[model samples]
Target chain A: MALVRVISSDGAAFLVSQRLAKRSGKLKTEIETFRKSSDNSEAQPEIRIVTIRAEILRLVLQWLQQHQNDPVLPANQNEQDGRGDAEMGQSQWDRDFLAPMDLGIVMELILAANHLEVKGLLDITCKLVESKITGRTVDEIRTAFKLKSDFKGNEEEQTRLENRWCVEN
Target chain B: MDLNGTSKEVEEEVSQHYVSPPVTPEIAPTPPPPHLSGETCWDNLPPEVQEMVVEKLGDKPKLLRYRLVSSSWKKTVDMILERQFLSVWTEWEPFEQYPYKMNMHDYYDYICGYDELEDDDRNPTTGVILARAIIAGVPRLRPIWSHFAEHDRKANLIPSFDHHLPAVHNPKLGSPIPSNCLRIRFNDKIWPEIKRFERSRRAKTLADFVVKYDHCFSYLRALLLTDIEISPSNLATILGKLTNLRALTLEDTLLHVEPETQEENAVLPLHSNLSHLRIISTNSSASQLILKAYHEQVISLETNCWVPLFSKPYGNLKRLKLITNLKPDAQFRQGEENPFPALKYLSIIIHEGHVFEWDELSRTIDACPRTLINLYLDIEPRWETEEDKIRQLAMSQVTIPNVKTLGIFLPTIPQHAECLRRLILPKFPSVQQINLISGSWGCRSAIHGKSENETEVYDREEVIRRLNAAKIVAKNVERMVLELQFYATVCPKLEYIVII
Candidate 1:
C-alpha cells in the first residue's frame, strides 16, 4: 500500500495510507503534485500543514480515517442547497466525537477542517459552532465565544439603535 | 509558526484566497493551538470560516444579535449582509404586534431619503424591513412568496413578526431564485384586510403601493404575477415601471380587459432587463395573452404551455423546459429547422396524462439541437404502473451525444430497468454521467452505501430478483454492469452512473 507522511505545525508526524490521506482534498492534491514533480518514481510524499497544529491535525485525520470510504463530496455541494448537507451527513459517531470538545477547540477544528478542504468535516464543525450562536442572547454568545465587547463607547448604542431597522419584522 | 519554506509551498498548493499567510503578530497562523487555555482566540477563526458559521446561523434575528457579540463578529456579519442584503422582499402587511410600528411611507421615504447605502453603522445586513402599513404584497400572496425569502429556511426567523398570518407554509421550503433578489406577489385575499386597514390607516391601491415602494422595487430581479384580475392598463403600467426585473413569471396574470384604457390587443412595452420569462400553467388563451404582451424580449422560457411558440421560435432561446404529455406537438418534428438554436439544456417533464407513444417521443428527441449538453426526462408515473407505457417509453430514443448528464426520474418499478437497457443507455452513445433517481427506497439505500453500510436499506434478494426479472445483462447495454445492491459500473466515457 502507498503511504504518505502528514506532518503538523508543531513537527509531529503521522503516517497514513495514500488512500486514506487522499480523502482530504488538500492531501490528495499535494500527493498528486508530489508524484509529478519528484525525480524518484517510488518516493513517498510528505506534506506539512503549517496552519493546523498537531492536536487539530490529528482530529481531522481521525475523522478522515473514519469516513475514508465516503464518497468525495464536491466542495461546492453545500452551497448548491440552502438547507445544507450538514444535518444529513452528521452521524452518531460524529456527535459523540464532538460532544466532549471545548468550544475553543471546536473553533480550531473548524479552521483545520476548512483549510484541509474536507467539506463534510467543515460543515459539521461549522454547524456545531452555529448551535452555540443560534438561539443564545448576545451576551450569552459573547460568553460562549469568550469575546469582549470591543465596540467603542457610542458605537454600542448606535448598534443598538440600528438593530431596530428592517429585518423580518 | 514556520515562515521558512513549507508555508510558501503550501500557499501555491491551496486556493489563492484560502492561502494562510505567514504568521504576523495579529494574525498568527492560528491561535497557538487551543493549548494556550486562557487565550481569547476562538473569534480569531479566519473571516471565511466566520462567514460560514454566520451562514449556518441562517436567520435574521440571530444574525442581528450575532453582531452585538463582538467587534470582529459585527465586521464579519456585515460582510455577509453586504453580499446577501442586495434585496429586501418587503410585503407591506400589517405587523401591529411588532413594537416598532413605522409607516410604509415613512420607511420608504427614509431609505430613499438617504439615497444610497453608506458604510455607516445602520446597514441592516439581513434586515428584511417588514412593512408595518399595508404596502408591499397582500396577505394571501404571502404563502406562495415567502419561499423566496432567505429567512424562510428556519421559518422561525422571527418570533413576533408575521405571527398573526396563518402558518400554512413549510418553514424549509426551498427558495426558487437567488437570495439577492426581491419577490413581489399580489393576490385577492389581501384586499379585504387592506380595505379595512386602508380606510382606517394607510390605504393605497396596488399602483400607488408600487409607486410608493419604487426604490425598494429597484432591487426587484424576479416578479411573479399570478391570477391577477387588475385592469389591463394598470398591469401594463406596473410591468413597464419595473425596469430592473431580470425574470418574469406570468400565470394567468394579464386577464383584465378594460377597453377604455387602450386597444384590446395593445402590445405591452418590452423592458431590456427581461431575459428569462416563465408562463406557469397557462391555458391556450392565457398563453396567447402572455406572448402578445411580452414575447419579443424573452430569450429563455420555462412553461407548461406549448401552443403559441409553434410558428415562430424565439431564435435565441438558450434554455427551455417543456411540461406536457409525451405526445409531441406537430411543430416539434424531425428534419425541421432547429427552433432552439442556442439551447444548452432541454428538460421535458411528462405530466400524468401521458400515453404510450414512443414514435412521437423519438421525433421530439430528434428535434433537440446537437449542441445540447444536458437532457432531463422525468415521467412521473405515481402509484400504478402501466407495462405498455414503460415498454413504449423504453423504445423512445434519446440521440443527443453531447448530453453529459441525463437525469431520468421514473417510478422504482422493475420494468423501467428494461427500458433503461434497451432504449435509454444505447442512444446517449458518449454521455458522461447518468443520474437514475427513480427507486426512492432502493436508490436512497444505494446512496447511503457511499457513506455507511446500507445493504439492508433495500433487501438484497429483492433488488436481484427485480434485476433478473428485467433481463439486465452486460450484453444488453454497451457497458452496463450492475452490482448487487448498487448501480452498474461506470466506464471511462460514462463517468458516473449515480443512482439517486
Candidate 2:
C-alpha cells in the first residue's frame, strides 16, 4: 500500500493508505505536492493538520476508510435532492459510528471536516447538530448544544418578545 | 504512540488505490467529555459553522427559536432568514399564536380560554386588515373563524360571508390576512384606485411603504404588493433582500419585460420556506414570471386568472383556488393518472355562462387527487334551461372520497333547488359539510371600478345595492341552504350547510 502519515494538532500520528487519505480533498493536495517535490518516488507522504485534535482526526479517517469505495458525492448535489447530503448516503453503520460521540465532539468533527473539505463528514456532522435544534425549545437547545444565553438587559426581553412569534405550526 | 496502522509492505500494483484502517492506540478512550468545556464550545464555533448548524435547523419557527440561544445565533438566524425570505412571498398568518392543530375543536377551546394579545392596531397583518377598510368602514375586529374555521356553532351560525364572496369561512374569502404581512399600498399618482381607498382619514393607519418600514425585514411573513411593475431581477432583489415570507399576494402588478431565463440559482438553497403564492389581476406574462421563479417552493396557489402553466403536474400543491374560469380549454390531462397527488382544497369560480362551460369543469375535476377534502365551485345565473348541464355534472364518474367540505354557488333562481341538490350531493360521497353560497362576483367585484363599496368615488346604485346585498346573502341564504341538505339519502355523512 502507498502509505501517508497524518499528524493531528496534539502530536498524534496516523498511518493510512495514501488512497484513503486522498478522500479528504485537503490531504490529496498535500500528498500530490509532496510527490512533486520529493527526490525519491518511494518516499511516504506526511501531512500535518494543525487545527484538528487527535480524537477528531481519527473519526474523519475512519469514516473515509469505511466509505473508500463509495463514489464521492459531487459538491453541487445538495440542492437537487431537496435534502441534506447526510440523508442521501447515510447507512446504519454510519449511524452507529456517530451514536456515541458527545455533541461537543461532533462540533469538533464538523470544524475538522469543514477544514479538511471532507464533504461527507461535514454534512453528517452538521446534520447531527441540526437534529439537536429541529424541534427543541431555546432552553433545550442551550442545554443540548451547551449554549448559554449571552444577551443582557432589555435585549433578553426583546428577544423573548420576538420568540413569542416563533410558532412551529 | 503508534497512531498509524498500516503494514510496511507496499502494494505491488502501484497504480491501484488502497485504504488501510488507522490503528491509533493512544486515542482509544476518547479524550475528556465535552461537557467539561462544552458550555462555550457551541458559542465558539465560527459564524460560518454556526450558520451551518442553524441552517440545519430548517424549520423557520425553530430557526426563530435558535435565535434565543445567544446574541451570536440571533445574528446568524437573522441573516439566514433574510436570505431565506429574499425569494419568499407567503400568504400565511404571521401573528398566528398556534400551529394548525389537527383536532381543531379542542384547539379552538384552548385558544378561546386565553385573551388575545393587545394588537397594535397598526400593522396590516391584524387589526386593520384591508377588508375592514372596504367593508362597513367601521373597524370591527375580523372574527377569528374567518381565517381558520371548524369550531363553535356560534361562528357557524352567523355564516353569511362575502355576499360578494359566498362560501364557508376561508381567510382568503373575507379580507386578506395580515397575521404575517406587509401591504405595499402605492401613492395615488402611481395607482388611481388606491388613491380613492386611502383618501379617508384612517389612511394614515394604512401608510408606510416597505422601503421605510425598518422593522419589517427581519420578521416579514407575508408581502402584499399592489400597483408595482415587477421584473424578474427587481422582484428577486426586493423579495430576496430580507423576508422570511411564506406567502406572497400581488395585486394589479405588472411585469416590465420578460428577461431571458437566468442561470440556475447561484444562491445556495439555504431556504425553501415559501408556500403561498397569490397573483391577482396580473398579466399572464407577469404571472408566468412569478411562477417560474417560485415553482419549487409554492404549496398553496391562488391566481385570479388561470394561466396555462401546468404542462406537467407541478408537484406538492395542496390548496388551489382558480378564482375565475377553469380555463375554457381542454388542458386538464385525462386518463388514469391523478395529476394533483397532494391536492386537498380546490375552488373553481366560474358561473354557467354557457352549457358547455359546466361540462368542462366536470372533466377538469376528474383528475383530482384522492387527497382532496374541500371542493368549492361558483355556478349560477341560469333558468331551467341548464338542468341538463347540472345532470351531466352529477352523472360524471368523479367520486371524491375525502371531501369534508363541498362549496358551490347556490343559484337563487326560483324553483332550481333540484338542480343544485343533484349537482352537488351525488359527486362527493364523503362530504360532512356542504357550503352553499348565493351571490355573483359581478354584483360587487372588488377589482371592478364600479364596485359597491364606496371608494371616495361611489358610482350610482352599485354601492347601495352592494351594502344591502351583503346583508341579504347572510340572512336569506340560510333557509335555502338548509333546504338543499335534504340529501339525507344522498350524502349520509352530511352534517351542516353553511351559507356564505
The fraction of correct interface contacts reproduced by each prediction comes to 0.25, 0.32
lDDT tens per residue, model 1, B148-240: 124333322133222322123212211111221333333323233323222211112455545544543444566655434455455565666
Kindly give the stretch of ten consecutive residues in candidate 2 chain B with the minimal lDDT sum.
Answer: B106-115
Q: Who wins the TM-score comparison?
A: 1
TM-score of 2: 0.42
**Candidate 2: tens digits of C-alpha lDDT, residues B374-421:** 877665434446546545544376777898887765445323455556
* Deviation from native of the Cα of residue B188 in model 2, angstroms: 12
lDDT of 2 by residue, A1-169 (tens): 6789888766577887786787788998899899999999999998887777676787888888677656678887887657668888688988999999888778888888888888888888888878776777878888886666776655555555443332321
Candidate 2 CAPRI grade: incorrect
For the predicted complex of model 1, DockQ is 0.15
